[model samples]
Target: HNRAGKGLGVQLFHSIEALKTYVEGPTFEEPVDGITLIQEYILSPESYITRCEFVGGNFVYAVKVDTSEGFELCPADVCQIGDLF
Candidate 1:
C-alpha cells in the first residue's frame, strides 16, 4: 500500500479492547503481505504531514501533505485518488 497514500492501512485505537476487536474482526485487512506494525500516534498541531524525498542520502524533493481529507495524499492521477493536495 506504499503508493496508495493517505495512510491507507493506518488505524488508531484508543484502548486495548478496541484494538483486539479490530484485529479479530473481518474489517481488519491489509493489502500488504507482511507483518502488521503497531506504533504510537503523535498528536500534530497542524492537519498535515511533511515528507522529504531523498535518493542515496541526497535530497530530492519535499511536499507538505494535507491530512484534512483523511490521508489519501497521492497526487498522481494514476492512483485515481482525489483532489490534488
Candidate 2:
C-alpha cells in the first residue's frame, strides 16, 4: 500500500499455528523453505525525492510533488523543453 509519508511496510499472516505447521521446527535458517512473516522499514517516496535534486544552469531544483497548482512560475505550453531541467 502507498503509505505516503509513513516509512513502513507491513505483511499479515493468518495464525501462529499455520506458521509453525509450515516450518515444522524452528531454526536460525529453515531447510525446507517455510513461510515466515517478514517486515522491513523503507524510506518514503517523498523523503527519497527530497534527498535528490536536479542542478542545471543556475537553478537547483528539488522534487516538489505536493506543490500547489497556482504556484507555477512558467506556463507549461510556453516553457521551452530544453530550458526545463
Candidate 3:
C-alpha cells in the first residue's frame, strides 16, 4: 500500500467472501487507477516444503514444517545424510 500513491481510504477484508462482497456490490466502484491484491497460502513448518531463493550474496534455503536433510546434517554429518529420502 505504501508503494502505491493512492488515497488513504482503503478497506481491508479478512476473507475471500468479504472481498467478493465488496467488489460485487453496487455501492462499490472499481478504482480507475486499479488495485492489486495478493493472497498467500499459510502452511505449517512440518510440511516438508522447501523455500529456496537467492538472498544477499548467496543462495538461502528454508524448510516449512519439517527439518530438511541439509539441516539434519552439518559439518562432518553432511555426508551421512547424502542418501536420505
Candidate 4:
C-alpha cells in the first residue's frame, strides 16, 4: 500500500452498473494524480496470474498472483493480477 499506492481496489464487477458505479464512485487517493486504468475483465480458472521479471535480457524471478483475495499484486499488505498483451 505504501509503495505502489492503494493498489487495484475492487477490480471485479458482476454487471455494467456495478462497474459504472465504481468508475464514478469515490476511491482512495492514487499514487499519481489522475492516473487510473480500466480494462476488459476476463474469467480464468483459479483466478491467478503469472508475472515474470527481466533484468538486462535475463530472467530474474516470477510471481503467481492469487486474485481470490483482491486485485492488488504487490508484495506488501495490498496488490493486481492483471494481464497485458
Candidate 5:
C-alpha cells in the first residue's frame, strides 16, 4: 500500500521522495530541518479498521472503514460509503 498515491491517505510511503511529494506536492525540495522516523510496520490481511465505542458499560456505536480505496474515513453526513461506492 506504500505505492505512489497511497501516502497522503495512510502515511504509507514507498520511499523518501514519495513521502516528500505528498507533503510538498509534485515539486518537492528537501527541507533542512525535516524529520524522519523509522518504525515497525505490520501488514494486515483485512483492508479495514473497525472503531467501536461504548457508553454506560453497554454497546454504543461501531463502524468499519475500508482501507482498499484509501485510509481517511470521513464521518457520516460528510462522505459517501458502501460496497459499491
Candidate 6:
C-alpha cells in the first residue's frame, strides 16, 4: 500500500487503541508510522459519502464515495489505484 514511499491519508477508526495498533503494527511491509488523531466517530446515515465542488454560484462537480467499499480517499487518480479512493 506504499505508493512512491508515502502513506495513504486519513482513516477513521472506532477506538483510539485500534488506531494506535494500526499505526504501531505492521500493516505495511515497512515500519508503520503515524500521528494519533482523537476525533469523534460519527455514523453516517448513508453508506456513500457525497463530495461537492462549486465555482462561485455554479456547482462544478459531485461524486458519491461508497464507504462499504473501504476508506482510501485520495483525490488524485495516480494515488487512487487498487483502493479506489
Winner of 2 and 5 under TM-score: 5
TM-score of 2: 0.19
- Best lDDT among the predictions, by candidate number: 1
Superposition TM-score, candidate 4 onto the true structure? 0.52
Per residue, candidate 4 scores C-alpha lDDT tens digits across 1-85 of: 2334234453667888987786677864453456556568787877778877788999999877666766666654323234541
lDDT of 2: 0.38
Model 6 lowest lDDT segment of ten: 28-37
Candidate 1, position 71, lDDT:
52
Minimal lDDT window, size 10, model 1: 1-10
TM-score of each: 0.69, 0.19, 0.33, 0.52, 0.41, 0.43
Name the candidate, 4 or 6, with the larger TM-score value. 4
What are the runs in model 5 whose C-alpha is more than 4 Å off? 1-10, 15-41, 53-60, 75-77, 81-85
Ranking of predictions according to TM-score: 1, 4, 6, 5, 3, 2
Q: What residue pairs clash in candidate 6, if any at all?
A: none
How many clashes (backbone N, Cα, C below 3 Å) per candidate?
A: 2, 0, 5, 7, 0, 0
lDDT of 2 by residue, 32-80 (tens): 3353334443435442223234456544655434322221223234443
Best by TM-score: 1
Q: For candidate 5, give the lDDT of residue 73.
A: 56
The pairs that clash in candidate 1 are 6-71, 6-72
RMSD of each: 3.6, 15.1, 15.2, 7.8, 8.2, 6.5
Instruction: Name model 1 segments beyond 4 Å from true.
Output: 1-6, 77-85
Off by over 4 Å in 6: 1-12, 28-40, 54-59, 73-85
Off by over 4 Å in 4: 1-6, 26-31, 55-58, 76-85
For candidate 4, list the clashing residue pairs, or say none. 71-79, 71-80, 72-79, 72-80, 73-79, 73-80, 74-79
Query: Candidate 2: minimum summed lDDT over ten consecutive residues — where?
Result: 67-76
Task: Write candidate 1's Cα lDDT for 3-85 as tens digits.
Answer: 33445667779999999999899997765655577778787999888888788999998888777766566644575634563
